[model samples]
Target: MWKSGAACSATRVGVATIITTVFGMALADALIKQSSTAMTLWQIYVLRSALVLPILLVMARGRMNTGRYGWIALRSLALVLMYLGIYAAIPWLELSVVAAALYTSPLFIAGLSAIVLREPITSRHWLGILIGFAGVLLIVRPAASGFKPLALVPVGAAFLYAVAAVITRAKCSDMPTRALAVWLNLSLLVTGLAASLYLSRTGVGAGFDYPFLFGAWRPMSGRDGWVIVVLACLMIGISLGLARAYQSPRPQVIATFDYSFLIFATFWGFVFFGDIPDRLTLLGMGLIMLAGVIVLTAGTPEPTRLEKAKVARDQPLVPCRVKTRTRPQRTDTSPSNR
Candidate 1:
């Protein structure tokens, strides 16, 4: 039938979209890590977002209307926290390690969906959650010797990301994806500005460790400026790609393809940084990835486009019946699922 053919085509588009989006994201992570020694995280946040927000405004083209500014700002803050957690650990952990640890967002999403969204989570979903946590443990190896607590930072980042996704569906669902991105960049800009000011004024980072995070801004070369520009472009691309993928009729397909981020992260790590994952790390990454696939694809439904923010990027789930009202079925952007 025409419907079936159309479904398959849409699924393909979603798959391609998510794969490309995460590829750019993974590459951006590598670039940031590579540039960490040259630029502070605050500096890059200020410069990269400062460069991108104008272009995004231009692209938005006078369609900057929204009624849920408060919720949107909160969602953006959650993402900013997620961003901080992931990036702050970069100087300490390997790329693959951070990537694997951050992928734990789906498990957090699963749990949060049950608690906050009141969504239906099947037995299989619970199994996936357990497996995902096991993978996280393997990656973090808390019981092992010489363990750094920073390894758990990305795990916490995953939780923040889940909160953002939930807020997207619960409150900011009426906004546009472009607007969501613009607000996120704005928040990043504000955060960078605030952090820079505090650090400069307080002189905390003057003698403290973690120069990339809390230290004062460093001088940039022409090459460094161009690298920041490239990062901005990648951010725009990933944001738009994520929107496109999630807006496709078959968003679940898109969510499934997001797992490619693990592979891309590992590839870039090896090729660019010459960093390789040890056997346990590799196994842990595999488990985390497998858990995500299961969490996303299991107990699912045919998905549709999300509101302004799309998350839960790799899976779809159905909500349980509520006595109060009938809820329109919407897929998570990683439901609100990717």
Candidate 2:
């Protein structure tokens, strides 16, 4: 009974960690949306990355190593690409639509799990995947009159983001959560620098006048600048918190917490941008959230097929056999002999 209570407590703690991560992530997105109007997304990315370095260094506190540096770099690159794709698409799509589209990551993760993790997909999981894709359609609606094809960018990002999450789950198991957190922040910093350089070279330094840079340089108000800085700090916190939480529990359990982001996204959109999601977007996002909830509750780790098959081979097929003679079977024969 005590053990049961303890397990329940641990589950509750895991749930709380997810809640914290989701809210932090949602707020980070909201800040990005606000800052996008006044600052280049590239600038925001650069500023956020620069601001996070000190925090991550403090968090790392001397545990950094040369080993696995390449993997860390790879993870960082994937994350930067994921963010860049999502941010670029937001201006072209509704905030809620983008959020819902990106959150469809669980569906991608499911497919990746089957291939990379060798996890079995039950009928329910398949159904969830179908429902999730349907949800995406409702948001993007390529069939709709004059729908923009660019809206697919976030969906593409969602796939990449799912891959990153799977990699984190697979590769970071042996590394310190703090170490991974710090490395990811550093990677983002590097990615930001690269983006800035590219922009500068193209004469699209930062602003609406720059068009694709979204202009060469739109100066930000001091207040908005501070908000961007605060948001960067929040991003660091969210990344660190998520890394630590996954270290303590299964990804399946952690994934459920993602639904919380939808709620926060809706609330923040309304509060910060006066953005209200239309009925279709709300319906789609609800389905996406439901899909994530179901996927997490299913509790299957995404593993490569090889590892799964190997594990299966090692399990006992049946209980050990014990041969014995029954005394009753010999009684009639004994009586006849007597």
Candidate 3:
């Protein structure tokens, strides 16, 4: 029973929020890919993390004490691994391809939930998982003569992301959102610093000229520094928009719109890096997007026995009664006797 005007207004807001979030994320990825050419991946991570910390702290203010340190650290480590895999892949793989592969996290989440949470797997969920992996194979195309093993990197990233998501749900469910954000950025900063220092000592190796991975800590160009700064701000904006979108009354509706990230990624890839997907790859991306939508819309709700019993008890009961026929019986008996 939605009012049409209100529904339309909400839909508009949701669409705008999703669009902004996806664009922000895509832009951040594009900037990272660009920055990779001039700096090490660790440098980008450290700089971006450094820039984001102040913003996160300002937003979190005094509300950053809600999360348990152990769980937060675990989740942050998972995220660091996830980002490492993804940023490494971006330099070698097309942005759209990497993004499509990363979107497989939803399927991984479903499988992980079944294993770790002992949740039941429905036929529909299984079908979605199968289709999703199939799409991944199409993108990776390991058997194909032109296959690049680097394509698997994003798949690894997706797995880590799924693991982080599972941990968040299972262990950090009560953590304030801002507190979680703070810990995540802090982890990124520490990991980045460690990696950068190690690489600085080892030096960039042959065939690893990509500044984002093996390059030494050097002065960044004015332009690239600004790009990183902008990317950092965009990350914060994207996080906020995502929070708003998912927190909306119609999460399913907003969730569906999240697939737009692939489209935005594709557009940015073309515009920024001139990276284009082949016909087969495009088909694979479409399949992945479809499978993601299916999984997202097919929510897995596990009702406990107590909840089920409560529902049953809440239902109205119908009464049944037996009618007596003593008067009719007596009349028939008297007639028979006479």
Please, what is the whole-model Cα lDDT of each candidate in the order they appear? 0.88, 0.76, 0.84
- Report the Cα lDDT for residue 147, model 3: 94
- What lDDT tens digits, residue by residue, belong to model 1 across residues 125-186? 88888888888888899999978899999999999999998899899877778888888999
Of 1 and 3, the candidate ahead on lDDT is 1
The order of the candidates by TM-score, greatest first, is 1, 3, 2
Tens-place lDDT digits, model 3, residues 122-223: 777887888888899988999999899999999999999999999989999777777788788888888889877777676644357566677777688899
Stretches off by above 4 angstroms in model 2 are 204-214, 247-254, 299-338
- The true-versus-predicted C-alpha distance at residue 28 of model 3, in Å, is 1.1
Candidate 3 ranges beyond 4 A from true positions: 1-11, 202-210, 299-338
lDDT of 3 at 97: 92
What TM-score do all the candidates reach, one by one? 0.87, 0.82, 0.85
Pick the lDDT winner.
Answer: 1
Which lDDT value does model 1 have at 311?
61
The window of 10 residues in a row where model 1 has the poorest summed lDDT is 300-309
Q: Give the Cα-based TM-score of candidate 2 against the true structure.
A: 0.82
lDDT of 2 by residue, 1-338 (tens): 99788766776777788788878887777777766667777677667778877877787887887377767777767777888888887655666777788888888988898899877887677878888888888878899996888789988898988888788777756777777777777776776667667776875544444343444345778897798788877877787677656554355666677577778878888888888887887888888888777766664546689978998999889887898977765445566687
